[model samples]
Target: MTKNELGIQAMQKGNFEEAAKYFSEAIEENPTDPLLYVNFGNLLAALNDHERAIRFFEKAIEIDSNTATAYYGAGTVSYNKNDFVKAKDFFEKAMKNGLESSDLFFMFGMTFIQLEQPRLALPYLQRAIELNEKDIDARFQYGLCLAQFGQMEEAKKELSIVVEQEPNHSDAYYNLGVAYAYEENIDKALSMFNKALDIQPDHLLAGNAKKLIEEAINR
Candidate 1:
């Protein structure tokens, strides 16, 4: 088997040292192959060696500037490092280079959210949902973006779907409560908050929301 294949097998088996050795050998044997550098970069990123991973990704980009995979890899590493600006730049480059996928769209959407531009986040998130409707995290973020944009009813629909699909999602319940509260449905909001607290007793936001609603009702 090729060294790259063996490396992948090792990674799947959780033998990270063996995986790294195989990937390193593969890189040595195929020094000019951008894919090799990209694969090695992915392995290093999995090992949490972000600096080395970025170097490998940069090397891949230097060797083959047109390949979207290298840019996407760098973008993911930057996102993990909390470098949102760099992540956004790389992700846009990846898209410009024809790397289109639900995950890529989701990351791009999330980057906009991190930059506190929910309006800009909306369409990318919608595209991600179109690509993979079953992605609960994307839907959750879409709901949040909608709420931030003052589209509370739309947010409620999305968050409701999330809670229905994943009943134990405390955050979904909490967000649903927020949506109801915005509509002035105080009883429904309090009930949703109570449900969130039932699932996660230490949910600070839900606890506080429940207390505030109760006080308002008492007054």
Candidate 2:
């Protein structure tokens, strides 16, 4: 019934114009409500108006510096823009402001990975997986980070779970194959690569891996 609720409904239905109208009306009615500005910032971010979205988020922060949601919204926009440094900063600030969730931890991990700090990414990704075990992407990233750290057995365990949960995941199969190859289990690696290729014939890395394994076995 409220304008903010109607705006949320419109946003959920992908009616951006109506959502914007309602959000604007809500802001007009309660100019000091930091949540209203945060919601509007989210809408603008979804619309790819990153500059305006950051402005709204900053306004929300101006009104209430302790609003974690505003920082999170700004961080999301920064992440979308590939400004990983700013994204990581804002995400950390959100955490300091008492925001804690699986999604936030996942983003923190991903931002670290993007920054080529896989070591730093590990703890956040591990926590993310602990919080939401069903998150395939988070599990995959965690597995990849483990692999980077030479924890091949742990990597295989995580990737195996992904394949078990989503049988058609070609990337999981490919990564699992890589882990097997690292462990020098050539036959198992070859089988895993073949499975990945079966699911995605155009997977160049899997195809190349299979070929290399076959050649090495023949030699």
Candidate 3:
């Protein structure tokens, strides 16, 4: 079997080590192919070997400077290292090239959040929701961003939708409980905590909230 085909098959099975080996052998056979570096970088990145991953990513960029995947890989590792400025720069470079998607935009928003730039996170997250309204995790993060920026009402709206769509989402209920508590709706807050506990009995926040609610009731 062709090395590239074997690499693809190995990757599909999550055997990244074998995939990398096959890709390396394929690279020896076809050194000019940029896709080989892409495959190798992806496998190394999956293994969390950031230094080697960046090397392969750099090779991909050298072969074709316009490949967005190379920039994205470098950006992701920088973000993983908590270098938000570098991460932002690489993500922007990727977007300027050919990378545009809800997931990428959401990642940019998340990087802004790490940089304590909630305002900047808003537009990216809003764009993500606009692009794909069905991304529940993105919706949750948007609500969290709103909450961080003191937009409690808006945050409640988004989180409430999560609860409505997925009644068993403990985090959604917990977030709603927090919002209600902030709004001075103690009864509603307690009810949300109860719902959260019902959904995930071992949830730390729900367990703590239940104790607090029972204490309040006893008082």
Candidate 4:
């Protein structure tokens, strides 16, 4: 088998040392193939070698200048390194180069959140939700972002949809309860928190919310 094929096989089998050796040999054999750099970069990233992974991705971009996946790989490494500004820069470049996926939008949104630009993140997350309404994580985070921006009514609507979709989702229940509380719907907030606790008996937030409800009731 060709070194490239062997590298791919080792990568799929989770044999990182073998994969890296084969990929390195492939790079020496065919230094011009962007796929070689990308594969090497991917394995390095999986190994948590973000700095080296970024270099490989940049090398791929230098070789093929137009491949969107290289930009995405760079962006992902930057994001994983918690460099939101750089991640955003690369993500925008990737998108401009024809990268399109709900996950991409969601990743950008998350990076924006890290940058404390949650308002700016909202549209991207909303698009992600539109692209894949079934993704509970996207909906749940989108709802929380809305509430963060004081868009309580809109947040309630999104959270309500999530609870409908997965009645036992503890985090959804907890976030939805927070949305209700923001809207001053105290009864609904208490009910949702109670349900969250029922789903996850050890959930600290749910237990705390339940205590708050009891205190309010006693008041």
Candidate 2 lDDT tens digits, 56-97: 999999999999989999998999999999999999999999
RMSD of 2: 1.0
TM-scores vs. true structure, each candidate? 0.96, 0.97, 0.86, 0.87
Clashing pairs in 3: none
As for candidate 4, its clashing pairs are: none
Task: Give the Å error, residue 56, model 4.
Answer: 0.5
For candidate 1, report its TM-score.
Answer: 0.96
- Comparison by TM-score, 2 against 3, better one: 2
Q: Which runs of model 2 end up more than 4 angstroms from their true locations?
A: none
Q: Is candidate 1 or candidate 2 better by TM-score?
A: 2
Error of 3 at 149 (Å): 2.5
> Lowest-lDDT window of 10 residues in candidate 3?
205-214
Please say which candidate is ahead in TM-score: 1 or 4.
1
If candidate 3 were superposed on the true structure by all CA atoms, what would the RMSD be? 2.4
Candidate with better lDDT, 2 vs 4: 2
lDDT (Cα, tens digit) per residue for candidate 1, span 1-219: 999999989988989999989989998888998988888898889989999999999999999998798999999999999999999999999999999888999999999999988899899999999999898999999999999889998999999999988999999999999999999999999999999999999999999999999899889
Error (Å) of candidate 3 at residue 21 is 3.0
